[model samples]
Target: MQRANEALQTQVTELTHGKTDHQGSDRHTTTTVVNFQPFSQEIAEEEIPEHVKTLALDSYSGSSDPKEHLVYFNTRMVIAGVNDAVKCKLLPSTFRKSAMTWFTTLPPGSNADFTEFSTRFLSHFSTSRSVQATITAFLTVIQRENESIKSYMTRFNELSVYLEDSVPSVCVAAFKNGLREGRLNGNLKRHQETSMVEIRARARSYILEEEDNRQKQKRDGTTSLKGATHLGPASKFNQAKTNRPGPYQARLSTRPSAPKPLKVVNAAEASKETGTAGMNATCGGTMLNAPVSDILKEATCL
Candidate 1:
């Protein structure tokens, strides 16, 4: 009887232990299976915010990658007609975030930002026709943002000053004019002055050439001096013998008489004599009167 009681106790203890272990395993499996779907749903909802949804809805919405999304957001900020000053303040911070995000996602040592994205973005305004339209649209959007034209101009000038290196000619001109008329400070004007100095330096050669030509014509007695040296060397020798004067004496003797007034030659007579249209022919059909080099330089400076 004692042995049988001991066996029964042992059986009860083993069964109890087996039941406890089975219950523990079932609880662990239930926890994992039951909580996973709800947790995953929560995570998915948390990852996508309302702003991101709205951005995705927009025509120019950015990428799914956070870094790319940041760049896209900033680019859309400009396209969406955000104020320039605001954009200037926002862009650098967003750009840093974008770069960081991009770097983190990329493989170590990958070259993601090596491409000049800004250059590609600005290239859309490389021509006059497109530039004018873009500027007009941007200005219109700025005006609608409760900002004055002057304020808009100032901001635009500030935004584009660094970008001037890549901006088109018409766009730069438009920006310059806007700054000149506006709430913008004199920064563009100062740049203009520097550009003008460079232009004048470049055109110096042309100006000097024009001045030299004028001086030469003035000293050469205009058209009248061309045929004055008519005597051949032999005739000059005969005249020297007849006059009994040395070469220097002939020059001195000729200097005493009052100089005769030169005949004012007409255009036709001058062209006929020269077998060309005078200076006009040599100048490639352009009028020599207009200061073309100076005008071109001034236009470029502006």
Candidate 2:
């Protein structure tokens, strides 16, 4: 009976691979009609919102290998709709007992926290993200150049919790160092007293403050430029002609002159660096200045 079952499984595997090959050929034949996308495996715990990531991972749970699922999950989180912030509302009722209980316990309408979810999911389903590995990754985390301050803070807050044995000060230092330096860093650095709470608060406000200041500066500049007189296209010309001179001095001043031409002297002289004088009148599109001829002659002799 065992041998028969083994044989049946082998036959089934061969049929599956064969079917996949047939489907691949059909897809190639109808490229215009078919749009295919591969399933993802592992996800970056930091990247996607808590809810959507859960769904992606859950969908792949039935695959043959958890390791492949983990990799595909990572690819999905890093890519997918993470930047768009398209979050899903996960159904706790649909989840297995362990995850379902964790979800049900959260405050009403609250999404599962990414840290909590990752811990529960990885511990129960997959060993790809071991505790030590997660902690190490968290410790070495740095803010990506394209990542927003809010996203960076969110990820930092989630990861820092795993460092239960480490002091807050150490984690705070790591978080501070991880943030890309800007007005946010400057404001936080100004306050002598340090804490994650203080940093988080300031960071939240910093982006808004920077944006407002930028808008104000832009408005002021536009107004000033509009009010100012333009004698001609170039502002320097207006300044040079006026400069406390009489009002009529600007009128009397000639229009600003065009830039002086650069003297090439000779085309041959210019083309010397290029080895071939470019399409000369005498050369008739042939190479001038004996270009490559010496090398060719040397090769011929050899």
Candidate 3:
């Protein structure tokens, strides 16, 4: 038994190496024969061998075809190794025909159909290469039926619910928010630049006006000192005329000996007389003498 097992192991290794070599050669060839297989067939659950059935039931409960589901599950296992989260939830008994029913009803280019398909099957699978290979196989079948690539892509988009439902929602929200913020920032930047430009233009205009006024004043000989000197000349001419007495004023000054200079009653004398008249008129008594400043200071203090 041990020798037979060893022989089987060696044969398996050799077969694996041969398959790899064939695949490499096929990659370089222009035309290579490829196999086409359909995934629609159902395997009888009762006919499944006990050990394999136990394993399949544990992992492929939601799939319609246990055999095909096993292939997809194994491929995912190989691709994701032990790090995949969704793999832990798979069970053989999870298989339900309704899970894949949406695929049959989907029109050629409907996103809803593809979305349903992806949600039912593709999302459960972990291996990108396997998923791609499966998609390519489906595309080959579709092309064989003379469908356009556009129709295929439309179906593909419809089926790829993972990208459409989750990734784009999160990514597009963040992207749109970032774009909105950037636009607002750009608008603020433009407004600031415009305000600065207006301020600089206004400042330039004010400086130019000031410079023009200075230049005109200089050209007209009306600069500060020149204007002051011109005003002084007019004042000097008026002073000379005022210093000479008028012809009629000389005759009137000689008469009446100037009447003792008429003891001019200034603002202080007038204020004192008015205050005394008010006190006499109000109290009917002549209030005794007090200096106007003293009276004003006493009244203010009171």
Candidate 4:
């Protein structure tokens, strides 16, 4: 009887152990269920149109400007005529690396709509947003010394692209202020209310005139240099000839001439003789309108 009771107790214990094992397995299954997602039920359920399969988007890895990526995404979506629901679905496909990791970490059902999703994305990546340029930035761009007006214009125009709301008059003002002081600046100052179109036209004319003047000066300088170079050889030859000794120089060099003997004569007698000789020559018609002192001066000069 005791053995039967022991057997019955063992059977009861086995059945109890099996029930506990089954319950433990059921609990484990319940805990394994996952529910993490950033999108709402509506967005998740939204059907992606057939046209979306043909489209491809470049992925963002959180390294570049997030705002630019959004702008590009929005532009394409607008062109494709996709709705907000479709935008939400398509946007995630463009994310990779850190961007995808960021998306995955967002709380479930946090994004109710495309607008909210975009807003959150922008807010989270605010540091990665491209700084919107202002008119102040344009004003600060001064034309460097010796910088060409054409080059300055190109730089100014390139900067203007960032300032979408920049007025033509304001641009003209900024451009005028930034110019190196010269005829262009002076001309711009005279026209207080000039349009950018007129400013550009005036600049073009000035650029042409400046180029022409530069070319003329260059040509003049080249001609002057050539003239100097052409005359250089002749001048050098003349100088060398002047300094060079004659072929008979060695033969001509001989003993110095003896000093003349000193002669003493009366100044009055000499003057009297010179005056008489000059009067005779003047009267003979050989010397015309000649005075004694003039004749003396001419003899002295000779």
Alpha carbon lDDT at 199, candidate 2: 68
Q: Write the per-residue lDDT of candidate 3 for residues 221-252, one digit (tens) a residue.
A: 44353112222233445557657778889888
Model 4, span 1-302: residue lDDT tens: 99999999999999999999999998886654355567889888988888876798888987776778999999999999989988998998999888898988888888889999998887666533222344757768898866667768878876554332335666777788898888888887887745666777889987777556555545444323211222223344555765777768845775477898654434444447557444332233223234577556656555
Q: List the global CA lDDT of all models.
A: 0.43, 0.52, 0.40, 0.70
Model 1 root-mean-square deviation:
30.1
Q: Which stretches of candidate 4 lie over 4 Å from their true place?
A: 1-132, 164-166, 217-302
TM-score of 3: 0.18
Each candidate's clash count:
0, 11, 18, 0
The number of the candidate with the highest TM-score is: 4
Candidate 2 colliding pairs, count: 11
Off by over 4 Å in 2: 1-131, 143-148, 161-167, 190-195, 214-302
TM-score, cand. 1 vs. native = 0.19
- The deviation in Å at residue 165 for candidate 4 is 5.1
Q: List candidate 1 stretches off by more than 4 Å.
A: 1-69, 72-133, 137-153, 158-163, 179-302
**Residue 144: error of model 3 in Å?**
50
Candidate 4 clashes between residue pairs 3 or more apart in a chain or in different chains: none
CA displacement after TM-score superposition, residue 173 of candidate 1 (Å): 2.2
Question: What is the lDDT for 40 in model 4?
Answer: 87
- The CA lDDT at 111 in model 1 is 23
* Residue-level lDDT for 182 in candidate 2: 74
